[model samples]
Target: MPSLTLEQANQIIAGALARSKASGFKPMGVAVLDDAGHLKAFAREDGASMFRFEVAQGKAWGAVGMGASSRALMQRAKDNPNFFVSLAATSGGRFLPQTGAVLIKDAAGQVLGAVGASGGTGDEDEAICIAGVESAGLSAG
Candidate 1:
C-alpha cells in the first residue's frame, strides 16, 4: 500500500498555508491524517482561531474514514441526515460531513490519507486542500 511520507505531509501543509496566505483568507488551520485516521501533521496560522484545528482535523478524519471527499459526504448526509448524524455520533464527533476536506490518493487511486483546512469560506478551504495535495504530487479525491 502506498503512503505519504512525513516530508510530503510537511510540504502539503506548507503549500496550503502559502496558498491561504496568498489569497488573503483569514488565518487558517490545516490538518493531514494518515489512512488510519491518525494525525500526520497540523498547522494553525498565527491568527487563526483555536477551534479551527479541531474543525480541520474532524474534516480530514471523516475523509479518511469514509474514503471520500467531504463534499461527497455532505451530499450523502443530505440524502440521509439521520444516518449521517448517527455516524458523527458513532465516530465520537470526529466525523463531520462538510466541504473542505478530500482524500489523498496515489497514482493508482489508492487512498493514502486526507487533508483538510478551516479559517476561510468552505470553497477557500477546499481550494487550499487541493493545492496542498497537488504540491505533494498527490491527487485529491
Candidate 2:
C-alpha cells in the first residue's frame, strides 16, 4: 500500500494554515492520519485552543477508520445517532463523525489517508483540509 510521507504531511499543514490565514478564519489545527488510522502528523496554530488537536485528530481518525470522509459520516450519524455515539465510545474518543475531515486519495483513486481540521466552522475547516490535500498534490474525497 502506498504510504503518506512526512514531507507530504508537512506540506498539508502549511497549506491548511495558509488557507486559514488567507480566508481570515480562526487559528486552525490540522491533523493527518495514515491509512491505518495512525496519526502521521498534526499542527495546532499558536492561537488555537488546546482542544483543537484532539478534535482534528478525531475527525481524521474516524475517516480513516470508517473508509469514508467525515462529512459522510456526519450525515450517517444524523440517520443513526446511536451507532455513531457508540462508535465514539468504541474508538476511545479518537473518532469524530464530523464535517471537518476528508479522505485523501492518490491520483489513481487509492485511499492514501485523511486530513482534518478544527478551530473554525465545519465548512471552513473542511475547506482548508481540501486545500491542504490539493496543495500536497493529492485529491480529497
Best by lDDT: 2
Instruction: Pull out the clashing pairs in model 2.
Output: none
Alpha-carbon lDDT, every model: 0.92, 0.93
Query: What lDDT is obtained when candidate 1 is compared to the true structure?
Result: 0.92
Global lDDT of model 2: 0.93
TM-score of 1: 0.97
Candidate 1 lDDT by residue in tens digits, 66-116: 899998999999999999999999999989889999998888998999999
**Candidate 2 lDDT, 1-141, residue by residue in tens:** 788899998999899999999999999999998898888899999889889999999999999889999999999999999999999998788889989999999899999899999999999999999999999999999
Clashing residue pairs in candidate 1, if any?
none
